[model samples]
Target: MGKLTATSAKALTAPGRYSDGDGLELLIGRTGAKSWVVRVQKDGKRRDIGAGSFKKVSLAEARVKAVKIRSQIEAGIDPVAERRKARGIPSFREAAALVHAEQKKGWKNGKHTDQWINTLTAYAFPAFGDVSVAGIDAAAVRDVLAAIWLTKPETARRLRQRIRTVIDWSVGKGYREASLAWPVIDKALPKQRAKVKPHPSLPYSELLGFLFKLREKETMGRLALEALILTACRSAEVRGALWPEIDLEAKLWRIPAGRMKGGVDHTIPLCDASVAHFERMKAHKRENNDLVFPGTSKGKSLSDMTLTKLIRDMHAADLKAGGPGFMDPVQNKIATAHGFRSTFADWINEQTSFPREIREAALAHVNQNKVEAAYSRTAYLDKRRPMMEAWAAYCGGSTGGNVVQLVNKSA
Candidate 1:
């Protein structure tokens, strides 16, 4: 029998180590916290390995573990390595990384790939990042969400989904028990007061003057920004523009599935104004470089900050001249590059007679309504042509007055 009994192990509360014989020892911390430890010798090296807490792991349980450790050592196994390898549970943070690395390649949006992990890192990591995934109960999950559930409803909802995704991934790996108790946790979390925040957008009425100002000092950055506005495409789409994608003859810019935000092929109709920007870029195209708007780096495109800084400078200049400086009239915030898409959308809804399908096509927005998306297979390249030309016309001084004249290819 071991030197210490269950009653004796609990009674020894003083700060000291007491041997239970056969390598097993009871350790009492300075704070009187008691735990079990056992020493083992293998390969001429001896080390102490923890069995568990004295209170939770009774004297009998500690003796049993000590016997198992000795048996493993006798069998020429590194008990330390075996114990580490058999770490009872994986952490939530570790599970998230495994899930991200495995699934990120399928996500087409570059921003989305980063945001997937970023949200977890920002919120979930603080609460139970290092805690064992298997140990996480509904209370822990509820506490992680309670702080933001009511204040930032949409973000919290997305965070909840992402948390559940990691938990579900852990469950598949056998790191968690059953599925997450989200249904039970949901009742504990406060009901979110849904608040939707849209991108700050310049008013459509002020777009004409904004476009005119944008064209005043013509640089590669301005040209790129104009292309983004005229085409109503996203920032990365315009910045990463390739020469081969542009077709002056067909009046189309074909963006392949890999390059598009949605993993679907998109075709953009080049209006009279958009073609002019491409024509200007044609003169500056380096023999080795294929980027339509190449940055200072040999083959690299301009950074997003380059365009952002350009807008900021223009805003400062506009404010200096006693104007609103391209402010989003509603939010009273400066207009953003992405906000130009919102501006395009607002103008299309208010001023234009173009059908909803055609407008969505112009912006390359995937319809959330599955039924509508099923019926709207046609890209309406022909219809968007006139609509874009008119948008260009409206963006210009009047009806197509400021647009660059079409160059005759016959020459």
Candidate 2:
């Protein structure tokens, strides 16, 4: 027969604890609201369970709740856990949003965030977006990825990784406690090993012929192609090259962090031939655009696929004319646009006695060892100066002398 008075409710607060008759406690809050709770001793150990609010739940109703909580104690069941189980499960979208927000800060760029959402929307959301997070299992994830496993193996892998990340986040945030092991449960969608396809490249003998033909058919596109071969740089790197990035007087091209694959600034030592080519390009430059090789339109750089398409057309024409087309030595098939890099690598290995490390550095490959790479930070621009000069001579069939040192006037 415990009564909670308005005065007592007003005095009680979050920091204070009080008890009513029959071992049931009436915790009065600072807002003058009261909550009924029951405290019991089971096996000489004290345990507490919240009964209900004083207004919504009458004193009699709270007594019933307290009695039910006592019964649960008698059965060795936690009443708090039972209340949680009674609540409706959260939808998958709700849990996923929580996970996404938690890990958004760790992402490096907006692109990474877009990828996260795109993967979920394309795979996870269609199946489980409306379903409860607690209801999702390993099988649901497996079905989504397995649908695209053979047709789109790389994309499937990304989807699996994204889903695993979301599930891991959900587990950490106490959303769902299911120990469902995704991607592994269905071994059919095992991570596919990336096959290293050789870059399409023309042999040294055919390379001169190819360049000669390109010179005869000299368009803006052909000039750009010549620049790509002479520099031995990636198509994107060459196409995206701005006039501002090139230092003609210094014979240097500085590729900024955003343009480079490793997200680090790189400096390329331009040979006399490359500088001459840039000088030629200056005569045809657009008034408003600063692009070293601007598109036929204006402002926009050449499309990434343009070079590849050009190479394909060149290969077809060569084949039709009974000339040696862009053929893979190993596969006996037409070489790809990207294969030029492999051709360059092969030529470097066979014709020159240059160190493999120097060639690799020229190709802008990242060194694996942190310590060794740090010590070798000069990028060997001086060493590569000769190599690049030799490469240009090899490509141009020029009987030029070896690279000479150009002393910096400031130095």
Candidate 3:
């Protein structure tokens, strides 16, 4: 096969089809249009791979493209199918944006969307920004996370998780056929080892002293703290508690599942002390506002940080007064406000012989085995009544003798 000059090929560009001198062919139609195509056979089957329009791809470039196609044919690969596959995979940036748009519709608020984008921009985008979605592999992902795994392990972990989610989405959408297997799946990335920190919890011994001081303070901070401890709830749950959710007469506080971290409604059985506290709060309730602990001058729920600061202040005051400060046996440090739940858990475990499931149910911890939990949904509120009463008495410095009455509202 000899080479075809542009002059010779132009001479054949009249109306129908003709071949270039090297067995690569060209087709010219009545509209003065010219197209270059390569004819190749594999497995006794003929196929045509379009090089490009004559005006765009020059003879030399078309020849090079044809040679590449011919090599692929010799390797038993279909060039047309390979081109289609390449076009299918989007760039990392484009695929991520598409995934973001699809996920944004289900997000409850704009904050969720903002968080998703912020995490990706801060961590994932920096490493895989320009890489094609199809080309990313486990090593590429490891390089992204390994850079920040030492100083920012938590951020790095979140970045890996988000990258996995994006790549998984791309695979589902056909932008990629396989996931970018994460190398940091079970082990920490290189140059970084997982740190062993103490679990956050308060000790049962220091809880009463803390509550005693909190009761004496008589501030909103103090009230919020007491409410949180009495209810055995997180700061967010106590801060966001509303008057409508409370039943003073029935002595119950129904925390909605949406407000609960575990997404299950928890019925807190109020003891006499908690009921008395609610009675005192009755005079403070606003006519239009619903929050049980509204912020000063804002008429909305108090900030979650308020109780934490109050706990810190109480610790400082105890230190100044030469009194015993809040201590956490588990962490061997000053207790955090959130650690009170652990204190309550310890009390239930040690001070009372309540059944394990009842204690776990009170703390809203689900059973790992679904079938077991489904069979045990009765919650044993009657059995839990005495336990909570004992806890309340311990917190209030009263003798633990009250036989808690079980007013079955369902009856």
Candidate 4:
């Protein structure tokens, strides 16, 4: 039987803990504030659970609530644990932090880890950070990603991936029953059209003239940019080149797996022009760093912006002279140092009889087909050597204007 009647619970004014019966109590404060609580014992330990305020929960209602809690205790379940589980559903922001903490160790570098969370913090947190992870649905995720889907497709794509990762982590931790966000959220986003502005690339016909002007400038920036074009390697790969990576006798530049984009070792056969250019750069090598293209400051690789700024300055100069300086015809933009890789690819496809696989291997592009990747162990260095040599001759004014159309009759 309960201790307090509805009439008595409201009439009491003193500040004290008073019991109703069957563990139900009326808690009164010194200021005469009133609330209901229930006391229960399980495993020789007593605990008090809040029922509600006396003003809102009547004695009859308190008894009903107490009865349910007692029933839970009798069934060997901790009511406190159940209550916490009910109240402690994680927010999206909290889950993201947990996911980051757990997964940061596996990431390649600190910058990548920061990028993973920074995107979520900037875009998704404001919209649904405080919302319960379990409560987050397709519409909520769509709302966050759709806003930037069109304007920042790259950012949106990364954000969507990180969000899905966080939600999947939540499900794995038993925080949510299912990850209802991904695949479905992908469909909700506006169909992103393929990007129109490819990296600006100079046409093969213009590359020789561009190389002449490029060679006129004598700086590490000029040499690095030239190496990038000649090898068709990524900026990082070219900028971070080490003295040990280059074997002048072998006429090869072997980039290790860690620095390469594909996470596989790549070998670039140095053309005569490219080899000579590297020899020139070797004279300017700093004592503190082995980078083939060291930054203006000692012991640092050339900044990515270094090459970009050089290209822009060249474009400005050409524009002043009323000449189109290494312009990408398709986009009407100044050709970038990175764009030279595409120029190389175009030269291969349009001018040479090299198989696409050989050309792609020269560019260090990974074969997407798993079986092909597994069986295609050879790098075909012997075949790529002649093509690179011809490319160098073309760049050095030894050839021009569809000079040698080595058409593959088999192809």
What local distance difference test score does each model get?
Answer: 0.79, 0.71, 0.71, 0.78
> For candidate 3, lDDT tens digit of each residue in 42-98?
789775667777888888888888899899889987665576466876767777788
Model 4 lDDT per residue over 1-411, tens place: 566777777789999998878888898866687878788898898777777777788788888999999999999976655754687867889989988998776543456678888999999999988767765768878988899989998688668767887887888877765666355566777877776345888877788777777766456677778788878899899989999999888899999999999999999888777777677666766786788877766687888888888888877887788877767754457888788988888777656667888899998999999999899999999999988997776677222222122122100
Model 4 poorest ten-residue lDDT run: 402-411
Ranking of all candidate structures by their TM-score, best first: 1, 4, 2, 3
* Model 3 alpha-carbon miss at residue 22, Å: 98
lDDT of 3: 0.71
Please give each candidate's TM-score. 0.50, 0.49, 0.48, 0.50
- Provide C-alpha RMSD values for all models, in order: 20.1, 22.4, 22.1, 21.5
| Candidate 2 per-residue lDDT over residues 222-318, each given as its tens digit | 6677788878788888888998999999999999989988877888999988888888777657888988777666687776566776777788888
For model 4, the stretches where C-alpha displacement exceeds 4 angstroms are 1-192, 195-197, 397-411
What is the alpha-carbon lDDT of model 1 when measured against the actual structure?
0.79
For candidate 2, list the clashing residue pairs, or say none.
199-339, 200-339, 200-340, 201-339
